[model samples]
Target: MTSQNQTFERLCRTGTSLSVHSTYEIGGEARHLALPHTIEEVSTMLEGATSKGLDPFLFGMGSNTLFPDRPSDDMLFFSLKEHIEFKLLPGRLFVSAGTPMTLLALFGLYTGIPSFDFMFLLPGTLGAGVYMNAKYFSHQISDVLETAYVIDKEHPERGLISVPLSGCEYGYKKSVFMRKPWIVVGADLKLPVDPQLTPEQTDELFAKIKSKNLSTSVLPNYFRHYTNELNAAARAGYELRQELLDVITDRGGKKHFDYPSCGSVFKNNYTIGEPMGKLVDRIGLRGTVRGGAMISDHHGNIIQNRGGATAEDVTDLVKLVQEKVEAEFGFVPEPELVIV
Candidate 1:
């Protein structure tokens, strides 16, 4: 056991506590964490973990996930931070899974493509976005996804097997990746050139996205120059208040992005005239607080970690919202977060 542990540590820098790395700014030490620069290192780590009876968990960007206060020692973590590669061909683009969705979106807009502008303010990497079939109001990642290179950890000898979009049974916030759960190395996306829109329509789409992101207080690329020098104090008062104001302006806003959170804590209503946010707002459960986490008084569907919040605290608060929503409106809400 010691020999294998040593080998795993040698393969990647193993850190003790990683709470600061989380978006929530919570959680305890990771038993082991690896940021492998190359795919070969990733393979070695996975193989070592398996042989040592440790469960391997692939992570990226740490955007859409929340870790436990202290995860099990048996769970080995590795992130593909260094695999972001892109190649532009005539009609398609080959990109590594680690590529930022924002980069792709910006590239699309510059190339006069449609539908990708929605990725302008979206967080997380392209891989996670595809796994979730990321949506932007009306557009979805699956709409342009041609093929993906996925590899089974148990059979790394096959390397990355390319699978077409048809192979992924994609739905609202779901994909076949959830079932088989392989590592996404690269993807091929067909460029948008069909049913081309007029220049006026393209301008309108970009404007619409910019307006939406502004109202939600989600940062846009244009604001990068201004938001770079933020210190500790600037983050709390000015930044947070601006976020709250955005929430106030849009009563049904998705503002988990406003705080350190894994986006929406609960899924929204599918066909109901009013969403889960509207229902929770009706019951006056907004601003509900447990520890450092609170149901945003500005938006109901969001539960924002106000700092120093724990996974247990978030879990308990979820139950609170579920009970209150069911008692008042006779409806139950499912969580979108995958609790570790």
Candidate 2:
């Protein structure tokens, strides 16, 4: 479908707030919200927004992000999240930007390839993940990424553009896409796919995983999730059993997932000798509460929403932690979350 053919009236909504769209459940209302399901729809909305002198921004699942208390009426937010695509080709995965990481993981697991297990537990949509070079433990999506289909915001007339992995310049939580007006529409993942796994073998692996009684604690709602590698390691007696358990388990394993909060308020200082969370813990910031926001008693890095917590409440606690942590260690930590 062409943008010229689809009417803007059909794709846009008015008086929508960020709290309803985001995972953090924060942000004020934008003047317009457009749920564009096609490339043409996206282009059309962008053109219309610009023509009206409105500032438009792309929004994904809203994970790891923060927005203002009251957005201006000129702001327009575009979402392509509902138009998702995922399919297994002979050797690679063809996934749209809106596809969930959890689905990617399950696809890999079912095919006898378990490398993406780390991603299964991650939050946010594929587009956001790719833009941020989303990392889990030691792995980032860049490690397995091959090519991404991008919409060059500067030149939408070029149509859907395909760029190789090198064009992205992905780093730890940074990418060229973040710098430019590039919007990822789709991506190709180059991960191992097992063709030898018979129906019996597939069933056996599925049964084994199911038998573990995997916690149905709802991953997106949680602050952190377990990696599939840990499960595989445990099953294979990977020799680092105790160490892996220690690394993977925090506050009674899955308890961290029970709380509503953006996980890890601070980004790790690459030059720091230890994790920022450790410094937060050593400074006795754990269990500190402000309004409905509380520094998790289980992990120092987390600021959880006890109940009915607003974005301001979380910001207050974040400031408090920064003040105390900096005073104690003489090191200011960077925020991993995107505070708009």
Candidate 3:
């Protein structure tokens, strides 16, 4: 056996529950799973999967993904959530794919940069954010992203390839990464001003942020942890920005973390002159239930795992929404939720 194959085997966990890895807290057992903490480790795992004839399924924190109820035995499920890194560059910030997107807001708070406040309570990791052009109101990752680094899934030995912002073909919840077999490794983000912190201070700040022991995949835990951090910062005399405060109010008002959910389940059909949530509301689909899943009463776009929801339950609701909306509104709303 190749060294990479041996290392991959050593790194993988067998018969693991996928629920713990997802924000929705639903899913059955995965036959094989691995969390790669570095780019090299990711490449090694991919190589190993190829040699073993296993189909590799890659994901981040699984905030936007739904794992199947019965996963294929030959599928290798892996995530990059363990590979968090932050680097302060001369003109920009370098963040690893696995770093939680919400951490960027804390970085902004510590560094006195307001640009990342939109990401304050956003779910998922940086790589997923980049892939979907994750948005909050009018703000998005594409607004701050300068460049992305990726590994071609078909050619892992080619190493990292840099794709400039213009090459990304970013649109409403879309990116070139979605069209290609490219795995996002990291990205260089633009900073409006100098962070004004020494390298040691940056390291210290990041370490402090990461030391909080929060589960990024669990909504309630993730919410409380970051909210407390903001409050702690306020007590330390770091003046809180209104934008940051507004994010808390907006997301909090919507009860985003009150239930286990993958946030918005469908993309807004912009051509319809209204959002998917409002459309679902118009048709009286809000608060609709299917098995253990329910359309969030607070927000029509969300499908929550109220308790013990299965992947099929969520997908059933998704299908119901799509069918009802299509019949009433003359179009099928595309799902934003990734069903694995």
Candidate 4:
């Protein structure tokens, strides 16, 4: 393995700050990381890691993730900042996952394409978008994605291969690549150029939507939600229904607001029970607390990390809610993947 001094030459800490806590900014000490400048370099680094008996965890834009206070020490965190390469072909633009989704939206807006307008405000990476089928403002990344380049997990040296869009098997936020450690080198997106929305018009729409979106999120105590609001709202009555959704939106996107929570501490298990919100509420987990983490008062299914929270705090809170819900209801809310 190369000495630590040598590794510093190829990669460096760019910047670090308090990231907004949400799937967008689930809390942890980032130790802001960067990747080598080229794909071959990245491959070599991966190979080097293999030689050293270490595994690197792939991180893109750090969205849709929660980092425990103590993440795996052996894992070398890398970012795709330099890896993202953008290109324009005829009417379509090709983008890489390291490219911010917002950047893509801005590119489309400036260039007069309306398809990416909804993506303008999403807090995720290009690769993350392809993997998560990122959704917001009424569109999913898959709707605009054309193709992507993925590495062969079995063969690190096999390099990146372009994969067809249909093969991604997008459902909700899950995708084929999401379960695997294969890295995203870049991606191609088919876009339109004619009769495009003016940059000003696109910006106006984006600002309005972003404002509405922020107001709906960034609320105190609310963590990320367990399911989409529309589904829950439909379950509730009409006027009350809108109120339900508005409440969710008012909290920052998901389980990462006003606390150090791994968003949606529990995953919704549709077959085992009724909607998750009602079940947890019945157990009185709504507004319950364990250490610094608390089951949100606004939403029963969420566990908020109040401040100075630890992984143990959140985990214990999750366990308490699960046990309570199971005793009261005939079901257990499965944990969304815990970082630790």
Candidate 5:
């Protein structure tokens, strides 16, 4: 469908649609968008939407999508945010996929490199933290990958495909480019070149790593809904928003975020019995609600859309918080993706 005068010369009707509940602002409208830069213009718009068979829904920095209040037209969204680019070599570095894990955490504190200084408290993108093998305290990013590149649309003119970091089978947010669909376009990683800091000690180690990740400049926390098999309590200070609500109300119950959401809606079933985030906060499903979606009055597995919410009000509030937490703790909980 690339000819509506070539999609009005690459579309953008009044832009602003965003996802993952509109930056936790909450759901809908992305009808048709575009934001490519190269890789032959994203293989000529994915071969002009696979010769009109259309199946293009890529977005590197909507942070982590979820747009669906009523907007699909089948699926056509794009945003590799002008496919960034980076390099370094001799111990590896490459990096692209719209770079910005806070500019690889200030290029790992101006190069003294503490493995991308934990991406200055991650928010998203580095291709959604390597398609979800994302991590922080416990580290992972395949521990400094080593190669990736991708594109593989069954050989779209053999564009890009590197592969390698143990062939990306990483887990928890899995990979192999999220089970093969490819199109990452960068990563090499390795690290270690410091040559002993000094450019005034790498600008005083990137101003003490951006002042220890911006000394909590009053609530900006970023995202990370849990996946901590203990990095000694994220190196002791804990905080990934109170370790995702202390791994979900640590047992009995009690969670309730406010406003902001899209954080967690499912994907915490440590075998269901214990640590399913304290059994879905003892089966209360936290703040619970339906219409303008709720559940987060601070964090019962975060739903929040609050005003004029949609995506069927967060898909009927995740089927009424998984049917009242499977009728009070028998345990069921599911609903990690369904903006439609």
Candidate 6:
């Protein structure tokens, strides 16, 4: 066997539960799953998969993805969630794709920079955020991203290719990354001001954050951990920003972490002049259920796995929402949830 094949075999876990990897807490057992901790490992795995004629399905955090109930045996599922890294540079911050988006908020809090406050409590990792142009109200990942480093999926050996902010072609919940066969590895974020700490201190702070066991995909656990971090920072006299505190209030009020969900299931139709949640509410579809999945009563845009929900259950509800809304509103809402 080739060294890359051996390395990939060592990384692969057989009969892994996809449920634990997704915030939605659905999906059945996957035949092969791998979590690569470095870019080289990722390349090795991809090369090995190519040699085996196995299609690779790449994801990060699984916050917005719906894995199949019966995954194909020929597919190789992999995630970059274990590859978190952060580096402070001259005028920008370099963050690995696996780093949680919410961590950027904590980084900003420590550095006394408010540019990343919008990422507070944002679910998913940096790669997925950049892929989807993740947004919170008016702020989005595109606003802060300066350059994204990616690997062409067709040619992993070609190594990292940099795409500047201007080349990303970002729009509302859209980016050029979405149109290309590329895997985002990391990005350089524009810094609004100099950080409050020295380079060594920054490294120490990131090391501390990385040491914490906060990488679980469970929504409630993820929420409680970050909220506690914010409170701890406030106790340390970091002076919590109102914007950061308000994120807690906003997301908490929406019950975003109360159940297993992939957050908003659909993109809002701009011409409709109303958000997806409001439209769902208007169509009297809030609290609708299919098996164990339910349209969240608190937020109509969300479909939650209340308990023991399967991928089919969630997709059934998604279709129901799409059908009912289209019948009423004369337009079908496009799903934001990525069904794998």
Candidate 5: stretches off by over 4 Å: 1-48, 64-68, 76-89, 94-112, 128-155, 161-184, 188-304, 311-340
**CA-only RMSD, every prediction:** 8.4, 5.8, 1.2, 8.5, 16.8, 1.1
TM-score of each: 0.78, 0.79, 0.97, 0.67, 0.33, 0.98
Q: What is the lDDT of candidate 6?
A: 0.90
> Tens digits of per-residue lDDT for model 4 on 78-196?
66644555665655566766666655654553454667756543445677678767666457878877888887644778888877888888875678787777787778888755435
Candidate 6 lDDT over residue span 248-328, tens digit each: 999999999999999999998999899999999988989988899999999999999999899999999899988999899
Q: Which ranges in model 1 have alpha carbons more than 4 Å from their true place? A: 1-8, 193-257
Clashing pairs in 6: none
Give the lDDT of residue 178 in candidate 4.
71
Error of 5 at 257 (Å): 8.9
- TM-score for predicted model 3 compared with the true structure: 0.97
Question: Can you write out model 2's per-residue Cα lDDT over 1-340, one digit (the tens) per residue?
Answer: 4455347767778888777676556678877788777667777777777667778778666666666677778878877666566555567777778666655665554555655655655656678888888877677889888998888766667788888999889876788887888888889898675456566764575455434332222334333334554456447654333323443453336355666656678878767688877888898888888877788887888887786667888888888878887888787787887776
- Looking at candidate 2, the ten consecutive residues that score lowest on lDDT are 213-222
Estimate, for each residue in 246-275, the C-alpha lDDT of model 5 and write its tens digit.
433431143222244545667666555554
Quote the positional error of residue 224 for candidate 4 in Å: 18
Q: Cα deviation of 218 in candidate 5 (Å)?
A: 20
- Work out candidate 5's RMSD over C-alphas: 16.8
Candidate 3: misplaced stretches above 4 Å? none
Candidate 6: 10-residue stretch with minimal lDDT: 207-216
Model 4 segments more than 4 A misplaced: 1-9, 12-38, 81-84, 194-279, 325-331, 334-340
The lDDT of model 2 is 0.69
Between candidates 2 and 3, which one is better according to TM-score?
Answer: 3
